[model samples]
Target: MEETVANFSGSNGPDNISGTPGADFIIGLDGNDTLFGLGGHDRIVGSGGLDFLVGGDGLDTIFGEDGDDTIQGSAGADRLSGGTGADRIFGGDDGDLVFGDEGNDTIGGDDGNDTLNAGDGDDRVLGGDGDDEMFGGGNADLLRGGLGNDLAFGETGNDTVFGDAGNDRLKGNEGDDSVNGGTGNDSIFGDEGHDTLRGDDGNDKIWGGDNNDVLYGEGGQDILWGNDGTDSLSGGDGNDQAYGGGGSDSLYGDAGDDSLYGDAGNDQLFAGDGNDLAFGGAGDDFFQGHDGNDTLKGQDGNDTMFGGTGLDLLLGGAGNDTLAGNEDADLLRGEAGDDDLNGGSGDDYLNGGTGEDQVTGGAGNDSIYGEEDADRLVGGDGDDFVRGGAGDDVVLGNEGNDTLRGDDGNDALIGGADDDMLSGGNGNDELQGGDGDDTLLGGDGNDTLSGGEGNNELTGGEGADQFNFDGGITTIVDLDLDLDVLDTSSVLGLDTALSILGSTTVVGADLDILGGDGSLLTLKDVTILDFADFLGIDIDLLNSDLGIISG
Candidate 1:
């Protein structure tokens, strides 16, 4: 290692040459050579064969033109290349441009914001620090766009990639491999394996290329797709949008107001938080709206869905599905098939759009509508409004003040708690008002009305109707004794006719003192177990009446 100008112009053999002290130029011509640029700002070239080039200091350029070569840029802003063969190139210290051209290679743009190019074959490239750009050309390659906001290209073949820091983009053109969008808002693509990709931070968009893949949007708002095959996707935080493009896939909106879709196949989706929108298009899908206000739909197949929290809206588009609104005010619809829908709490709206469905409004004020088929609806608590449309149906207003309507067909409407309203529109129906002051109307059928307690009004419209009374004050306002019958089984414990009172009709305002709950059965009909039985009299007449009869 002395001060000299050593230039091997025709060293056709494998040569080992070293440059020293001064500004030296060491060149290796042909054969496999070892060229070291030690002191001065040196220029070392491994012209041919499998060569090793080392740039010691100062601004240097080392070219491994042929064969599988290794080049190390020790302490300078260097330009290193493994020209043709499978090579290893290292950029030490300062900014460097390292390229592994042609064969399978490994290139590292160590420190600084350097450029790393892995030209051909299956290669691995890394950008150490600062802003780096990694170019992966053809073949299966591993490219890491390291530190700072970096950019990496996994151009062609099955490759593995990592975008470590800052805002970066890692694109896998083809093949099955794993990729990570380390931090910052980064975009990553699983261009083709059943690949695995993660967008670690910042709002990022990731796409999975044809085949089964796993994708994760770790934090921030992200967009992910399980493009094909049976894939899995997770939207970790912030608002995210995920779509299961095809096949039987699973999508999860872990947090934030995220929107998720199970595009095809038998899929599953979880809308974690924030107001989210989810649609499971086609096939039997399972969807759950975990928290926040969410909109979910199981487009086809016999699906099962749950509206987990907040005010949620769920639709079971087709097939027989089991849909439930776990908490808060929710709107649940079982669009088709013989379905079941349950609204868990708060004020909820439930619609059994079609098919023979069983629906329940768990708590709070609820509105339930059974559009078609023989449906069953029950309102759990609070004042509820229930409508049973078409077919023979049964509806119950379980608690609080409620309103129930039997639109068509032979239907049964039962009211529970507080004051309630029950209406039987057509067909032979039954309307039973359980407690408090209630109103029961038999619209246009040979219907039966029963008022359980408190003051109530019952109307039998256009038919041979029958009225049953249990207790309290019940007013049979529109009871045509010519076409209607009063069944007082509640007092007599058996059916008894209106003639039992014997024409002594006590009109509303002309009422006098009667025993029991101080009740006036009605201005017209006072049927059922009357106060006369409690007073130990078979006939009804007051002591003030002149020809009053006593049993």
Candidate 2:
């Protein structure tokens, strides 16, 4: 039968009202009341005071009406809804459904994996710590997958969905989604729009779909993909792999042995720790091998590279390039175009082929060679060897035992640190030995020599000579000796005549010497000197010095 009950007075609820079919409103006097809908789909409303309603047996509808009410659905697949005011709805036994409408409400699935929906406002939906399903609808909602694998959906607005310590599936749908894969292998998806997905402390798989997304694989070896658009991917700890699929992207393999790829467009790749490999697939690129042994290649376009630590190899192919080996032992080669190479630390080797280039070995035992064109070379530290193969070049040995040579063209050479050897092979050159015992030669052309430290040997051969020895002894040995008897006067001029007389004095003899009017004079001893003075000097200095000049 169809029955209707209405109360004008705002009372709590009617104490103990039981009905079958028809819509019912059981009102209570300012006290708590209990109502049950036994048959047919019925709506029961309790106004003002606290009340309790149960939709029992049939497909009944029970509302917790107004005041703080407790509603339950016992048996039968019924729908229990809670009214405005703080209320509690329970799906007791059976696969029942419950919705806590408006006001702050608590909804739980008592038995049989039930569906609990919290409608409007802030609400709490619990799957009653069972293998149940909960939905936090509208406003700020909290859904907990207490036990068992539960599917929790945070619809619209901002929501907190937790797979609380179990293998659960949580999705942050629409609005801004915050999901935590608490203590279990959970699958979380931040679908559509801008979202934040974190694989918190597990081997989790996360997808930051569309828009600009931030995906963080917090711990463990996690897989994260930035699908479409520009995205930020970080593989936090563990050996992680990251990919920047499209757009200008940033990928960081924070620690452990990580592999990073910049696929298409100009992208930035950072392989932060462990032995790492970085690739700048296309376009102009920048790469940093922050730590561990690394391999960097400037695959295309003009690129700049830094080999940060450990032994590294850098190849600059095509385009003009700049390579710096920041620390540790490294090998650098400029394959094409004019390039600049610097070996910053450890024992380094640099080869610049073709094009005019500049190369420096910043520290450690370094070897540098220039293949063609004019080039600049610096052997920075440790025992170093430098060769300027062709064209006019400038080579400097900054420190340590060094060997420097100007192979061709007019070259400038500076020898620094420890004992060093320098050769100004061809062309007019300048050679300086900054410190340590050094040997320098101006092999060709007019060259200048500065002997920096220790005893130095210098030669200004076949050219006008100037020699400076700021420290240590310098001995000038005449390499051009007049062994030709026919050309004695040309070799032994006034200077040679005085040198001969000084040599005789060293043997405890005093000899007075005089020069004849443009005629060569040789004073062998006192007897030969007096006889030669009386004969008026000239029987040819070559013959007299050779003992052919006799009194």
Q: Which candidate is the best by lDDT?
A: 1
Candidate 2, number of clashes: 5
Q: Which 10-residue window of candidate 2 scores lowest in summed lDDT?
A: 479-488
Candidates in order, TM-scores: namely 0.78, 0.59
lDDT of model 2 at residue 227?
A: 64
lDDT (Cα, tens digit) per residue for candidate 1, span 3-50 = 445543439798888777555788788888888888667778888788
Residue 135 shift from truth in candidate 2, angstroms: 4.9
Clashing residue pairs in candidate 1, if any?
Answer: 175-193, 176-193, 488-528, 491-529
Q: How big is the positional error of residue 357 in model 2, measured in Å on the Cα after superposition?
A: 5.7
Cα lDDT computed for each candidate against the true fold = 0.82, 0.69
RMSD to truth, every model: 6.6, 10.8
Residue 286 shift from truth in candidate 2, angstroms: 6.0
